[model samples]
Target: MRQFPLEMHHMAPGRVVEWRLRSTAGAQSPGPDGADGTADRRASFNQDKHFTVAEESRAADDPTASWIAVTFEVAGPLDEDALTGSLLAFVRRHEVLRCEFRRLAGELACAPIPAAELALDTVPVADFDRTEELTRFLVERFKRSIDTLSWPLFTMGAVLREDSATVYLAFDHIVCDGMSMPIVVQEVERGYEALRRGELPDPAPAPSYLDFAEEQRSRYLSIDEHDERLGYWKEFMASGDGEFFPRFPLELGVEPGRMYSIVNEASPLLDAAEAEVFEKACLAVDGKPFMGVLAAVAVCLREAGGPGVYRGFMPVSERGRAGWGNSVGWFVNTMPIEFDASPGRDFEQVMASVRAGFGEMIGHLDVPFVRAWELLAPREFAARSWPYPVNFFSYIDMRKCPGAERHEDWRPTSHVWSAQANGACSWFQRDAEGLHMNSIYSDTPAARRTMDGFLEALRETVREIARHGSFRRPIALTPPRRPALTPLDVAAFARRG
Candidate 1:
């Protein structure tokens, strides 16, 4: 193996290089029984891609560092000369795209390694019959590819042009997250278009993902500021016992396997009315609608024959606070929330409890889920009982996808759903033509029916609350209750205050 420094290194502000692979040449060796065979590991980075720039900076907050990998591909009978010229030009224009990673001490980091720049090598095969073989070969090479610094992860493949032939590029996910793919893809398109048109690609002045990662480090690293927050989680997790409400009847560990079923239905209500109802319920509970919705779902779970404990994980995006988002990186944190159930509480009272629980958790949103798990359980109980029970529930917040505006573009798509049960199920909500309450659980018909009935009962409960302040009949099994508070009492209290 050999590496080449970038001849056009100074074209960008960052370091860039081209890495080349040496050929077997006259070094062919004897294989088993003294017969000659090719070395399977022979590969040249120069043949497929190049890097314009790279950095050696380590993530101050995380042990991992970051790097960028860029590759070029050509299609059809193959325009070798055009592809070569285009790739060379691309490496010269963008410095960040050509970086590589290295280990610093015990932690991974990135360096301006001109030695690992992308390059192309000659493959003597031209038969189109090896198309599948070529694709598989490229994907396999990518699987072995690494950014060493950034999560030490790799991309599957980045396909450039697939007219008659296909080319792919891959990178580790540490320096990038799922959200960053669109920007990277768009830049690739721009680079290819510029090369095809015989012009220098315009340099885009966006900050790299590394910058965003550094920002995350600053916000989450303050121990003094975060201690109170951490302590809150410690207390919250310690609040519950080892018992968790399971979606399945058996203990969570007894699962044969999880099951998935699809539930699609149309609500007579228009989108506007549904939104109104949700907001109204929130207002009825003092205007924290997420709490209202979650409480409703909890009620449904209670009716669905749960393990008597309502708990699940919810992901909160920390991108918008002080220094996140805008740049592409993964900064999501999941918190475990438990809902205490009693027949004595009013639906609104339950909603208020959920609202307060989540509000407190968000104050400590910077803690990672792994760390939270550590703080929440006893050393012995941590491994056996779930940090939170398996019956997870989240509202479907898919409004990010354009609504009726792109209805014509949608085709009937089917997806496999799986929620591993520790003797529980995972449920999520999303807004479609109507409400979509998706349940993922063990592959049992009875459990599925139970969930369906639970959903029905939930809707019924919500409707009752919407029309009347309480259930038509008081919970018959509850202890005798004091007189319920009314809207007049609320209004008079507000007037007094």
Candidate 2:
């Protein structure tokens, strides 16, 4: 590992530039609590202990060759004083936020701390035209640091003026899963508020990211505890061809670009009458609405001309310990739901299988997903057996969104970024407010269109299952509105299209 010059340069009152020494040895360090010392941290997480970062001299042809950045547009008016301090405090309160790097045995690794050497860069707010640029920078940064903490894999850009401002978080999947994002944002809000009030905010006490890594290792070692779950996966994965599922044709092949998406409204079945039925259905008779969603999605794949072997990936939270309610770490386990997608099979049959499957897996939910894959799936090709790939479904408690609802102190925006993994994924979350579903498909135009069509078909399929309790052919619909385009429209359209 190379030593980083121990130099600190001032950028502003709240930020500074500091150097990190990369670790030469790619060895995983013991967690702050020693939870993962015995376990194979790298093997279990499918990630290494350390990652690398380099800054190249900027050139005319390579504008983005050196670093990743995100700049936001202020909403109503700019409040530089409050916003800037909040951002500085935000970095200080979170250990991952103040990261330093160095080499250990030839490996570049970042060390965690409760306080970071803040290097804040305040650019002219006028530089950004849209929020996309910041997100794009984050995407590039994540892609470059794919192997390490690649935890706190999230970044943000904010533009706060008196009238309005925007805040964004660009995330990396390894360090933080989608499930844990809300927790991080919530803390940021709390810290930002405390800074604004000139009070020290109380942060949640839980295992740090490094601690979680330690816990993962120890947890995996409890083979006796995980035997049942491991056994189940052994049997479950034994049936598949041991290949990582392909990226949903939608998300492939693109220089990471930014895309804006909103969750789709819930299906009509979520209404009172159907709500009871849905609850009872999810209760145990068959897979509940959660499992039912997966089953229905499996059916959608059959209708979409996808393979018959139905496999849905489900991510369950691993923050089961007390005081970990809102800890920011990647603690997700993906469960595989495999079934036959035969045309004649009734929805009830599928639901029953999925329900039973959920019950069986729930018993083994404690198993580390990485370890589960290692034991049950072949090491060389374990990636293919991810709970579900290309075609899968997820359910979320959407009723209570995970943040302060009042707009007094902060405003929140949602966005989807690249995980750099190879597959398309979709998640459905619902709460008292309503139902919302978002699918991440390959970036390829063809795959995107396929996902769009598949969603429409899945909606129809679920409607039939909920109301009719059986399958029925859906009528194809005509295309939606299209705009007339000229050559000029093509250029401007391409720019703003």
Q: Tell me, by lDDT, which candidate is best.
A: 2
Give the per-residue lDDT digits (tens) of candidate 2, residues 1-497: 00000011000111111122222323454353222223212222522321321111022222121111222223344445555555555555544433433344543334553343344455542333333453344345444643233233444555343455455454444345555555555665565566567776563343455566655666665564247656666666556554433223233333333322211111222433554455554554445567666777777666665566576557777666544555655666777656665667776777776666677767777676655655554443322223332445667663343553432233222334333323466767643323345555535554445655665666666666656666656523322322321111111211221
TM, every model: 0.49, 0.65
Q: After the best TM-score superposition of candidate 1, give how far the Cα of residue 92 lies from its true spot, in angstroms.
A: 14
Candidate 1 structure quality by residue, lDDT tens digits, 313-360: 666655566543334444455566766654567767777678776776
lDDT of the structure predicted as candidate 2: 0.46
lDDT of each: 0.39, 0.46
